[model samples]
Target: MFYSFIFILFFFNQVKTKSIVSINREANKIIKYVNNIPNNTWKAGFNFKSKQLKEIENIMGVLPINEKYTQSLEDLGFAIHHNSNNILDKDFNEIEVLPENFDASKQWSKCKSILSVKNQSNCGSCWALSTASVFSDRICIATNGSIDNNLSGEYLLSCCTGSCGRGCNGGHPEKAWKFIINNGICTGGDYGSNEGCQPYSIAPSAVELSFENTADTPECYHTCTNPHYTTPLQNDLYFASKVYTVKPKMKPIMYEIYKNGPVVAAMKTYEDFFHYKSGIYQYKTGSSKGDHAIKLIGWGEENGMLYWLAVNTWGTLWGMDGIFKIKRGSNECGIESRISGGLPKL
Candidate 1:
């Protein structure tokens, strides 16, 4: 009896230790660390604590924004460095008085796409989603709210081959913008809404937003995914007139969003960011994760700190109903580093 009792206690102890390790890997003990910070600007919670480490990595879905030229490309193919000198000239003079808090949705109340908060599901398609979102907004704004529609991120994810990078694994933000201008995309709504030419293939889920990168990027198709939708494939296509990367300065970025609606941006992600609940977020402490693309909608001041308002792809249940505010002007987490947007070919 004594031997059996000892064995039972040892087994339970081992199980306890394993459980602790799993939780740490999932949450990185971010809650404890974030709670300990003095005058914490943001609150931490178990937003992704139930997720596995691999799942968390999948959620941070953007490939490195700055990739080095590879010998493989030179050997098999050539890189296309589009001329940006003319496009960069499109930047407007510094606005004398920018609004304290300006939202694209509020500015363009007639453009319904501005109010959308999409979920990228378990796929690494943040690059495509943000690109499609910005394009949709720009289309509406450019056409004076006449062509209000959600362009298909699924088209970009599945059809934007080669330089755009792998669909679900990751993609480059600059290449994505270039793809929309070159190979136009069709309109599509969230998964299973059947509202457009090619709605997002990945189904929406409440609990499984950031599972491992198992969500399959659907095969590229020319026809509308929704059988009931009447728009022809070629007619459904929408193209951009111009695509360019905005300067990573606050003035340039603010001016772009103010004039052209939202712009897509890439930000370096850290483990602590998964637990973000509210307030102006600044990296407190955690291991650097990876790059993730997001849409910068506007800017505002909070508690003496200025922050850029951003939209996330992880669904409305997470992070201020799928939106967040990060410290602005300081390049916090490289949020101000790379911004890209385009004009819709209305």
Candidate 2:
């Protein structure tokens, strides 16, 4: 009866994606937001016994994920492949294609600004993640890397103009951008004290402040040399290629997250994501492919075992100090199928 899909909003009175409460408050409790992973439920049960886990381990050669049936862990967020070795389909190392040599001189003013995630679990905040990333990038563009800053994640989660709120479940990237372009975003330090997003007032008013702009994107002619750079986003480099342009209707927001860093993103949780403690995953019967709102920095093959170098918002407790590599290929997480684009556009 472990309907793993029974998330916080579906099972509880919670309106998805409200930010986490403080440590001393009940608002932030993962249980308050979501339901438990029922041991008897099929989604929770998975019909897999220790023997099966062992078999999966033997056959797949990795540990399977286990949960305390807790709400936070109930999502079974994502799973790495059991035998992950070949993740990238096409390999192109564009060293000289980078925008800049990743030097401080080339720093975008908004590079220092960061939007905080602030633990909006189970609310499907992919929208917020996308919006925040855009605003954060814009801050860099506006500042030209002169200001090492951090934006407010709580603000984006709670505000971000129109394209967000009520949790992480819904919103659009363009809407978020409209708000930022119309109204200057507050710095993370102004909200909390870090460069990431922070809690603010009149959460929804910012959405009303959203407006339009006519600034054209400068011709993307700048170039540099950095072996870490990838090109065209897709086309066999990184996961997949993402193309952007500032057309009459499409105002492509130009910003760089990492020259080449593996990004750890939250995925739509499903039955298979559980039993991932062993660092391997098997294809499941659902469309649980990664819908990464965030991008990783880079990836590497260790002894033929490829691991995605990713940055996380989990505060360094889970995975390697808030960073871990997922199984690359072999149908583990189907990451090969879920390619996010982040290449140098020189």
Candidate 3:
């Protein structure tokens, strides 16, 4: 009986050791698979271990690539008509001065108004996240860093309605700006934190398999009442006075970012974006995924490659510390197609 007990313990230990070895082997394969992409412009490494590799592509914080959504750009939620008053036509030569190079991260770092990078988790709410980020940055710039407040993407996700499109599933940045202009949004932090009017409902690391078929859009609410806890009244809400779209071109878009601070821009994303690590990202070859809205903060040149420095909603673990550089000048990935934002009303 004593020998049998010892054997049982030994057997369990061996089984556990074997399971660990198997997991390590699988992780090595995933890393090799990423490195093997032919002529890959960017590097890819493991953000998750082997056991989670099957879901690795989904865990990168991007919605799955869908051909149907890619075929129709309008379905991505960019408004067709923008307010003409806010349009900065080419005739306005005074505002068209493009510097040799520019980088907002460096320019605004001293003021502490540079927008903080955020994560969207499994929710397909990049539209709201991008808009809120730009809004937060603009408020800081407009106030000369005096009122640099972290605006709430959660308020936009759960409250912004009408033409803003459905929350989580997908939405438009311009429509979100309109919502903020019409109905103010309160301060909110990430999920699981009640620091604001309404924290993000979706928890981080909740991977969604597909945006089109599986993800459910959260219902919109007008108040900041969380079902789980009693919260104090939130009076830290802000609004925008004007929201407008920019023409999809290099000069105008650059001018907007240079003059007005960061603006939300929607661009085509691909399967390879999930594996991006470091390098100037020009779309190589991959299935064209749906559009993603990002905050276009600045631009610079690297080894003769002119790139746009955009802040992604994914956390700092992905890309160059939560930021990415895409080939500029040529409007790579249709990035220049849809750019829009507005001024903060103090």
What's the lDDT for residue 132 in model 2?
A: 46
Off by over 4 Å in 3: 1-41, 47-96, 110-115, 206-221, 225-234
Which candidate leads in lDDT?
Answer: 1
lDDT of 2 by residue, 125-233 (tens): 4444433443444334444555444433434445552323233434333233334433334433222232222332212212112112211111211121112334211
Clashing pairs in 3: none
lDDT measured at residue 194 in model 1 versus the true structure, 0 to 100: 85
Per-prediction TM-score to the true structure, in the order listed: 0.86, 0.39, 0.74
Candidates by lDDT, descending order? 1, 3, 2
Scored against the true structure, residue 253 in model 1 reaches a CA lDDT of: 81
Q: Comparing 2 and 3 by lDDT, which wins? A: 3
